[model samples]
Target chain A: MAKYRQIREDLRALIESGEYGPRALLPSLTDLTARYRVARNTATQALKELEQEGLIQSEGGRGWIVRPRPRPRRHGIDRYSRSTWAAGKAILIAETASQGMVARQQIRELAEVEAPEVVAVRLGIPVGTTVWVRRRTTFIEDRAHQLADSYYPLDLVEGTAIRQVDTGPGGGFARLEESGERLDEINEELAARMPTSREAIDLSLPPGTPVVELIRTTYDISGRAVEVMWSIIAGDMSSFSYRFKIPD
Target chain B: MAKYRQIREDLRALIESGEYGPRALLPSLTDLTARYRVARNTATQALKELEQEGLIQSEGGRGWIVRPRPRPRRHGIDRYSRSTWAAGKAILIAETASQGMVARQQIRELAEVEAPEVVAVRLGIPVGTTVWVRRRTTFIEDRAHQLADSYYPLDLVEGTAIRQVDTGPGGGFARLEESGERLDEINEELAARMPTSREAIDLSLPPGTPVVELIRTTYDISGRAVEVMWSIIAGDMSSFSYRFKIPD
Candidate 1:
C-alpha cells in the first residue's frame, strides 16, 4: 500500500478500536512525521483527506480532533408476535452488522410464548395468546451492532418446518416457503427515538444517540398477516434504503 | 375535533412554533385541564399520544417535556463566481421557505473566504471559485425533521433558465428539462452522521438525534454532471422513499 494509504488505514483502525474518540486530538504534524516515519507534507496530506471525509476537525491551537459520529442504530418496522421462525429472522437482520463487531453468535431457538400488546393488535390475535419468540444479536467484526427481540403467534409455526429458520441454510423465508406458505406482501412503519441506557451501551453509542425504529409485518398469499418483526438501529451509524415501485 | 385531539393540536402547535423547546416540561394535567376546560382524561390522552408518537416524553415525576430536534448546518461545495442566474435561483430557494415555521428554509453562504481549507476540499471545487451556499430544514407536524445544505457551480446556472426552479412549477430537474437539457439520471450518495451543537440548534433536534446526509448530482443526457444538491434529514422527523424499476 502507498504510504499515505497506510497512514489512513492505521488512523481509521485506531478510531474503530477506540484509541481516539470523538473530540480526541491526534498527534501534531511533527509528531506524526516522526511516528509514521514520513515527511511532514505527507502527514499533512493524510490529515487533510481525513478532515474532508468529516472524520476529524482542526482547531487552530488545538490541532486535529476527531469529529463525533453517531453510534450505529437499527432500522426496520416493529416486530410481529406470530412465529418463532420470524422472530429469529428479524434478529438476524437487525444484528447482521453489529454482532460481527462483538463476535457474538446468532441464536436459533424455536419456541412459543404470549403475544405483546402491539403485536397482538397487528396480528388480530388476543394479547395474551401463545406466540413464538425468537431472539438473536449480531457481532460484527467483534463489535455488537444490534439487539432484536421478535414475537409471533404459535399457530403459524406449529407442526410445520418453519421453526428451523434461524439455523436453516437460507433462513426463515426459505423455511416458510418450504412449508407451502406463500409469502406475499409487507407493510412497514418507521420512527426514531432515544434508546434505553442498556441499549446505548450495547450499541456503543455516544451518550445521546437516537435509534431509528422500524416495524414490519408480512402477509401470506391469502393476505393474512402471518408475521411481524420490529428492529432498532443505532441512528448515526446506519441507513435503510428501499426502492418503492410506483405501479403504472 | 375531539377534546383530546384539540388539546393535542394546541400543544403541538406551540411546540412547533418553538414555544416549548426540548427538555422543557409541559403544563401538568391539572393545569392543562383548567386551561383547555377539558377533563383530566383528555389531557392525559393528549400527552400519551404525543409520547407514543415520539414527540414528547414523560420525565418520570417531572411531567412531559419537549423532545429536542436536529438543526441543519450548511457546508459549501462550489461557488458561482460568474453566474447571475445561479445566484438568483439560490436566493429563491432560500426566500420561499424562510417564512413558514414548517417550511424548509436555510441559507448558508459557505465561508470559503473565511475557512478556505475546510470548505474547498469538501466541495471538491477549485480553491478560489465562488460558490453560492443554501441550507434547508424540513418539518413534519411542526417538528424539525431534516437538515440540508447545497452548493451550486457558478457557470451552470449563471444565465440559464434552470435558476428559477425554486418558485416555478417545475423544480430544478423540470426546469432543466424544459430548457431542452435532457436530464438522464440522478445519482445519490447517502450516509448518516451525528450532529454538532450548531447543527442541533438549527435543526431543533433533541439530544441523540441522528441525521441522514445525502449528496445528489444530476447528469445530462450526455452524462456530464450538471448540478449537485446535498441534503440532511433528521432520523425521526423524516423518512425518504424512492421507487426504481428493476432492469430486465
Candidate 2:
C-alpha cells in the first residue's frame, strides 16, 4: 500500500516540478511499469490514485495528461493603478505562455436578460434595464475550469466593437483598451458560492468544487462605471497579489 | 409575478440596508404580508427566494434570519516601506478596525505541522524541516470565512512569544513587531482555485464557490523568509488592490 502511495506522490512531484507542463500527457502505464520496476498492476494502481487526486486525467485512447492547472500570472502590480497606465512603459509582465499553459474558451453575448436585482442595484440602474451580458467558459486541456459573465450598460458599449463578442481568449479587456476608454478605477466585490448545475457542467468541476466569484466595475476617467465584469475562477488553481505604497 | 418579485426585491433591500442584521429573524410571515400589502403566499414566496439566494437561512425553530453575506475586506494598496509606515501613522492607525464594516476574526496557535515539499522549496529550507504550522480562522458574524495555515521556521519564532499565538484577533504582523522583527519585504503569489470540501464547510459556502489562494512570504529587514502566510478566501467575497511607486 505504501509503495503505491509513494508512486502517486512521486508522480505528483513530477507534475509540480513542471516536468510535465500543464495539459501535457504523461507516460503510458506500460512505460511507467518499466521505469519504476513495478508490476503492471502496481502501475495501474498509481495511475488510479493520481486520477482520483485530480492531478491527471485519462483521455480515451490519448492516454493520461497532466490535469489543467492555472499557471499563476504575475503582472506588474502597478498596471492596475490609473497612474501606472498613464506612464505607459514596459514593466515586468508575467506570462503563463512561457510555462506552456493553454486554455480553451468560448465567449458569447446575451441580449436583454433581466439583470439580477442585486446587480442592478449595484450599478444604480433601474431594475430590468437592458444590460449586455458577456458569458464565457474557460477550459484547461479540454476540461472546464472557469465561467465568467460580464454585464455592461447597453447604452455605453452599444455599437462599439464590444458588442461583437470575441470568441478568442482575453478578447473583452483587450478590445476595451483599444476602444480608447482608459480603464480608470475598478471596484471589485469578491465572494464564493456553491456551483449551480450549469456552473458545474460548464466548469467541468467535480461534484462539490466551489467557485470564486469576482464582480468588477471598471470606470472611465470620470470614474463612471462603464463595464462590470463577473469572473468565476476555479478555486484550486489560482492565486492573487497586489502592491501598494502607503499614502504620504 | 412581477409584483411578487418586486416585494421580494424590496424585502431584500430592507435587509441589506441593515434594518435586519445577521442572525436577526424576520418578522412573522403574517406581519410581512400585512406590511407589503401582499398575500401570505406572496410573502412566503419572497422568503423562499431569499433563502435560495443565500441571503437568509432558516434553522427549524428559528424562522428566517439574515445570513452573513461575505463582504470584501478592504486590502489597502500601498508599499510596505518602513518610512511609509512611520509617515502614515494616523491613516494606518485609523484603518486598524477595517472601516468598521466587517467583523474581525480571532486567531489562535495550535500544534505545528512539518514542512510540506512545496513550502520547503519556497522557504529555501531542506525538505522535512521542522516548520511550525499555525492554523487559524477568521470569523464574521460568528462564522469562519478566512482560514490561514502559516509555516514558520521553528528556530525563528520558537521560544519567542509568537510561537504561543494570540488566543484571539490582532494583526499577525503586529505580533511580529513585538518580537523585534520589522517587516521590510513581502513577496506574495496569488492564484485562484476551487475549494476543497473542508474549505467550503469552514467558510460556510453554499455549494460551488471557489477560493482565492494567497501565499505571502514576509522577510525582516535583512531579507529572509521569516513567515510564510497562506491565506484562503472565498473568491466571490474578496477583492485585492495595492499601489506602489516607480523607483526614481
- Which candidate number maximizes DockQ? 2
Task: Give the lowest summed-lDDT range of ten residues in model 2 chain A.
Answer: A89-98
Alpha carbon deviation, residue B140, candidate 2 (Å): 3.4
Off by over 4 Å in 2: A1-96, A110-131, A154-159, A167-170, A174-178, A185-187, A236-248, B1-114, B130-133, B153-160, B166-171, B175-214, B219-224, B232-248
Mind giving the per-residue lDDT tens digits that candidate 2 earns over A188-213? Answer: 55445555445655677643344556
Residues B1-248, candidate 1, lDDT per residue (tens digit)?
89897887788777767888888889898899999899887798788656634468778888889976544322111111113223344422343234322344433433223213334554467666676544556554466655655555555555554343243443454455556666555555455555544566777754445566666665666765555566666655544333222111
- What does chain B score (TM) in every candidate? 0.51, 0.62
Q: What shift in Å separates residue B202 of candidate 2 from its native position after superposition?
A: 7.2
Q: What is each candidate's DockQ, to 2 decimals?
A: 0.10, 0.17
Worst 10 residues of 2 chain B by lDDT: B87-96
CAPRI tier for the interface of model 2: incorrect
